[model samples]
Target: MSDGRLPTRRRTVGWIVAVIVMLLLFAIGWVMVRGFGALSELQNVRHSVAQLHKAIDERAVDRADRIAPRIAQHTELAGDLTSDPIWRGFEFVPWLGQNFTAIREIAAIAGDAVDDAVTPIVALAADVDLTTLGLSGSRIDLVPLPKLADPLSGAASALAAADARARLIDLDGTLSLIADAVGETRSMIEDAASTVGALHGAATLLPGMLGSSEPRTYVIAVQNNAELRSHGGAAAAFIQVSAAGGTISVVRAASGLDVPALTEPLELDDAVLVLYGDGPWRIPRDMTSVPDFAAAGSLIAQRWQSQFGTAVDGVIAVDIDTMRHVLTATDAVQFDAFTATSDSITTVLTNDMPQAIPDPAAQDIAFSRAAQAVLGAALSSEEPSSLLAALSDAARDDRIRIWSAHEEEQDLLAASSLGGALPHDDDHDVHVGVLLNDRTGAPLDAYAAATITTAFGVCDGTPATQIRVTWTSAVPEEVAASAVAPEGGAPGDLRTLIAIYGPQGASARGGLTTTLDRRPVVQQDITIAPGESGTATATFTGAGSSDPLTRLHHTPMLEDPEILRADIDCG
Candidate 1:
């Protein structure tokens, strides 16, 4: 045992053990170095991507082109650094393994999102004169749309595949730091996918809907926010518009009151009938109170055909919020009494003009004029792209909804936010929904204020969720309640239909109200007086979500709603 010189076999074994340890140490050292490099590369990729977005947003195509290669380089480097045999081997270490695997997979997805999905779309956008791509004043260009279908579809598919992959990654079990990173990554990918998917849908659907192939007609409902409805507000006026090739002209305009109630109501989903009752089925103005824009569009279309014997190709509904958004991109629109900018458009439409022009017929004419003036301003806007951006923004906020009558195109529309169809697809986010519908028969909703918040029962990993709405009637005592009294309403009284949709597949138990789309929905009717307040809350027992955040998919109001959460015990 003490001999300085050993036997040949023992010496060979000693040499083998020494070499193995050296290799192991070298492998560990290599991984450590690569890890640092990969992190740096990823950081560079993030920075480059941000720069790329800025360039794209600024419409600096040349700058975006120059930035592309940097992103590609870093994404490739990050992927290569994380996917080597050594790195892959570390992914077998149980919980530790998932972190490594998630990192590696996210790196690949990042590469795919930028290089394959975003770059192609950006390139496609650059290939065309985007300044006039969507709308220029009153005209819509359909000439360049068909060419975008294939590439846009491919980009959407790639991003959608990437999003699906990201959603499958379990973040709850991962380290907090890594989980946050992954969640952010997932959100970015999802947003990209939704945007590209919508673009793809537009490219495929707009041709026919815009009457590129043949003449078409559509009904446009501009909602009046003074009288609130589920989709936005009471339909104030309707415009029958016809399109051929690229030009759209107003065929006719009619007040919502002109159309008589349906002697026979359009068939509604039993759930809708139970909750909305016969109000929607009875009155033309209340037809839009149904939340499903697709259904509401169809109902309006049917009502129009019955009343005017006109068959329309599609339907569009917009509120003052949409107009207010577009005013930011267009020139100031002049009303009878004042100039309306983005900040004052809502008041000008719903409050000032109606109060200034008290004659019902005269007020309707002014309403129609104001709408057309806004359109004329938008068509002549110096920055046409800005109008498109505004419209996209409004659509995302649920202030504008379009529904196609064509079967092929409608399928795509029903699946996207472009149509404002109530979510039919199963989603992962915890959903809390609230709807504020005016029943006071007055324009007093414009003077109302509401605060919506989320509450948890016990906060010990609470499964029960509560949605609280504290609504206040802010109408002043001196102001007239309404110019044209469609029905009797007190200036001091605010009556509303408030519905709180709990989490998906959850029940309110004792708080059970009604069911919509086979999902539990709680609703209540309340009346509040001026300077007074009312509160509505719904508690659902089975509400749960893997996501730390809850999604409040409520009706878009005149004021941007803030969704707040309160934890009873954990706070």
Candidate 2:
């Protein structure tokens, strides 16, 4: 009777074990199905959002309007899948627990971004007549644009929150591939947030800057980067432009050389005196030497006033490449020796025109004529949106910069990258600056290229950092000699004062030309004949950081802007 009872207990235990196994299998199957469904929905959300962005970029209002609702729907679906009951059942499951948590986090991030930025953006899009805005002339109506400020501001706030949330996410360990995808989604959200922030700022500021109140006067200094300098390049030419009642007019135009010398002694900074000497101030002829645009613009305004007896409200500086970008809106203009089209204007102005007339005095004539022709064609352009787009593109590339004496106007420009001021940032973990002041008188920088690298670490309980700056000229030895001189100076010899602004509180130690006001300067002399690369390195003790972000604020040189970012781990 006892043996029979034991067999009965064993049979009962077997039935219980089989039931538990069956339930586990069912739960696993449900998790897998739910996870895959969430993933699919997330992918759909991504696709829909991408399509919406494309529609907005292409100004396809109807398509964007249609896609916006779909984006919201897909995002909501993704959120539902991530927060499904299956995830709750799998919360205690090994490996899948982390994945489920990450998925939910990603879904929430996406949904929040869509709600914060996309919702307001779509609503704003619906309210505005994009096609009409695009087709309008150079002048934009500021009255209706101010109404967009609230929505844009809301979108900006949402994006800021998204970016902050993204930084807090730990998308690693089990199911890291999915985690990586989630990380990418966070990056996209950050980018969208930045766009919305910019739109918000523009909405809030554009009305006043575009002459909603009174007329504004600006001096446009056209920099020829062939003779690259700190701020941009030598102001090769300048145009006085005015905006009144939302209309822009070219008041006057002349070569930089045409602006007469300043008689009075101009106050100068130590950096300007050390790098440029008394040339820019005494003569007001060379605007390139001073890296500070505010200072340079002040001097330029003085000269402008001296010449024209009219005060300028601000100064806008742009290089030759930016001019070519502006020309994209217009048809080609026939110059003396060649046609000035958007594609050819840079070459014609920098190479062909320079080479055609070697006389320094005669160069301005060509530049003035080319400038006038390009400006006329650009202003007369029927595609005002295209012109603005081209200008915006150039501005993003750092080819265009603006400095305003008016505090109110400058407040707006200061918030933008176009504000050509050396950043006084202390909150950043690391600040690295590579400022090049061309020693070569010619447009040799057009052929010169640079590479910058920084290594950081902690040693003996103190931070240590090292910066390496390498410069090379691609100009052939034979042609380099001829290309060396610009205006009137040494030929083939590329002499540059490379100022390396190291991390804050870090002293530069090594072979340095001179240390002026904490900035270590390295003088590089590269002749066209050698084709050899010049290298400069400086080690700074006590500059290491726990946070390994390396921020580079450099004078825009001839390099892909993306390639200049050097972010590496700190030891």
Q: Give lDDT per model, in order.
A: 0.76, 0.69
- In Å, residue 490's CA in model 1 sits off its true spot by 4.8
Top lDDT: which candidate number? Answer: 1
Q: List, residue by residue over 220-260, the lDDT tens digit for candidate 2.
A: 88777767677667777888888876677898888867886
List, residue by residue over 1-571, the lDDT tens digit for candidate 1. Answer: 5668888999999999999999979977887787667667777777777787677767789988889888888879989999999899877877777877777888888888877776786697577644346666677788888998998888999988888777767654677766666677677777678767767777888788878989999998888777888888888778888888877788878777777677667776776776778778767788778877888888889889888999989999888888888899988898565789898888887678767876655666677667766766876787777887787778767788888799888888887776776564255445667877888776678888778887666434546667788888787776544422223445557888888877667766456777766457888888877788898887766546223455577777787666676653232
Residue-pair clashes per candidate:
1, 5
Model 2 misplaced regions, further than 4 Å: 1-46, 57-62, 73-111, 130-135, 160-195, 261-265, 280-285, 424-430, 459-461, 483-490, 509-530, 541-546, 561-571
Q: What are the runs in model 1 whose C-alpha is more than 4 Å off?
A: 1-47, 53-62, 76-109, 161-191, 358-365, 425-430, 455-462, 480-490, 543-550, 568-571
